[model samples]
Target: MSRTIPFHFVDVFAVAPLTGNSLAVVDGGGELALELMQNIAREFNQSETTFVLPATRPDADWKLRSFTPKGVEVFGAGGHNTLGAWWWLAAAGRLELGDGPTRFHQQIGDLVYPLAIWQSQGKLEKIIMRQEAPVAGRQLSNLGALATALGLNAEEIAADVVPCQVVSTGAAHLLVPIRDRQAVDRISPDAKQLFDLLNEVGGEGCYVFSLDPLQPGTTAYARFFNPTVGISEDPATGTAAGPLAAHLVAHGLAQPGVIKVEQGTTLGRTSIIEVGVDAGSVSVSGRGIVVASGAFSI
Candidate 1:
């Protein structure tokens, strides 16, 4: 006989429904096998699917296992992945949220990330994650070659902006600043070359952005491509967003405050990822709206 398990469909980094990065949250999976988890994640074929099990550690409330569509288990504190699970839990009453600061520890593959979720009148006000200090990684000095790989000419490369560089909070993402919105939108990088280049630089993917944003008050409008990890373009990449925010602050492009980021426009799913940076760690926060929920039998 097949067992039925509860699952939730979530849209992270979007205020409205049906617009944001997608996450499939599987509830009550303490007994599920790793191979089964990979199959389930592949079945969902979302950017990432999470299996939430009872916490083994006393400090953690829940243990999360993240899997990409490539059928590989990922080890890290995924920003939207973590928030989306809790969002559904709070919405479904699995987690009791009081009108105060609630500290929760999320265990992912033996790694724990401290998260603070604020609630007001039983509504989630903010979700903040304390990430590791930003680490400056390999820098790409070849602007012309980079521009060509990103489907742009050398002339379109923004000379006034900072050079292409890699930054990591949890994951390393190459940050490339373009001249304007038009240039950013015009980017259609060669998939094979981008994947190879990112691998060459020890980066998971590349985040190409433009300071001139379509939305007001946004620090930048960006797009993340990671064909190497099986993600063509991410709607809202919280992991990379943190590094990007840190890069901006370190390079004197943005102040150490709440910086807004708009992403996923090209895919029709507009995502807003808020990043907070100060003298230490970076906090990436966003709202995850429950789009659908049901049970899966396997």
Candidate 2:
């Protein structure tokens, strides 16, 4: 005899059902073994898959564990995977939400984080998640090697505007400033070389961005790559966007308010990530829609 587990495919940070970053949300995954979870993640083959589990600690309302297609366990409460899972839970009526803003605690790894959602007339509005305090580390100085890794000329890097450095809200990713949107679009990275560079810089992924955004009122046009975790390119990465917003503010490149980041244009799944940085703390918020839901047999 076999059993099936319910799952949902959500488009996080999306304007429509199919846009933004796709995530697989698995319900009642706490009973499954670790190896089985990895196999399920590989089977889905998305950038990330999230498992919603019952909370072991009293302080948390629920527990979330996200894994990459490569079986790498992602440990960030502010990631799209976590947000999409919560969205699915709320939309599926798995959790009871109030009419206004309701708060919930999510246990990711060893720490618990707070998340809020707004509801009006029994409809879910938006989800906001607070990330860890911003931390800066490991500035890269070798522009020529970095350029080679990204398949661009050394002169294309806008080092005068902001230094290429690692920033983290929860997951540390290297933030590189580019000359323009065209240059950002033209990047053809060598994955192996880029992964090596990221390893050297103590970074998990690379976020290349330009000040000139294609969309008005957007702070930056960006692209994300995390070869270490087998994500060739992500449509929208909240973990990276939060850090980029803080990095810009720390370097005096942008104001410390609501920073909108436009990404995934090159992939055709355009996404907008709203990040707010105030007094060295960061928060990321977005909305997601359920495009597909089914069951996984075991």
Candidate 3:
């Protein structure tokens, strides 16, 4: 028998209540089937919907399963899916917090990560996610071809600042650099072309960046386009931001330290993503706000 399933909506990596990327979180997934969760995700149609379940392994505190509206399973080594749920639980007083920062573990697939929750006065202030160690993948040799695919002039592709390369902290993304903010603002990509190009290069999507940021404190301005998994543009992408930080450090564009990034302004929903790099590991953290919640019965 179909039952009413309760889900929460959160603005992940948000600066304000309504901004940042949106997500739907379903708790108590141990009794729910994978197919049911996928159908729920399709019904929600958010960027992602995450299901929280009791941890099957002794090492992990909880289990998370994330899906796109298209029912595509998103890799969850580190991203907003896990963060949003954890944030909701901690903020709602569902998770136990002993009056200070608490450490826990979460598992997605074969990877288990250390999760830190900071709660002040029974409200979640922020979540610090330690992503997988950075993996510097292939640098695109065919910048001209990539430019054509992204609808950018070959000259506008900031080859001098840093070459567009494939990088992954967990999920793979092609990081492209534009010379200036004006160049970044003018991008109009053929979705099909960009999607096909990324698929061929082993990336889930591409993150176009500009060193010329809108604000002085932010290190870069960026936009994410992913058609392979049905996302045309993401407001904020923690998955891509981690890799972008590592890519910048590898190319000497930014020092090996905490770098702030601005995204989603062009789309009206502005978001700030923080990236921390030391040695080879990258940490991404941000704030999430609970926007809405409801129950859906099928």
Candidate topping lDDT: 2
Model 1 lowest lDDT segment of ten: 72-81
Query: Model 3: which residue pairs collide?
Result: none
lDDT of 1 by residue, 17-59 (tens): 8899989999988999889999999899998898889988888
Q: Rate the local accuracy (lDDT) of all candidates.
A: 0.85, 0.94, 0.86
Structure candidate 1, residue pairs in collision = none
Winner on lDDT (1 vs 2)? 2
User: Of the candidates shown, which would achieve the greatest TM-score relative to the real structure?
Assistant: 2
In model 1, the Cα lDDT at residue 135 comes to: 92
- Residue 193 of candidate 2: its Cα lDDT? 96
The count of residue-pair clashes in candidate 1 stands at 0
Q: Looking at candidate 3, what is the lDDT of residue 40?
A: 88
Measured against the true structure, the TM-scores of the candidates, in listed sequence, are: 0.96, 0.99, 0.96
> Candidate 2's residue-wise lDDT over 112-211, tens digit each?
9999988999999999999999999999999999999999999999988999999999999999999999999999999999999999999999999999
Model 3 lDDT vs. the true structure? Answer: 0.86
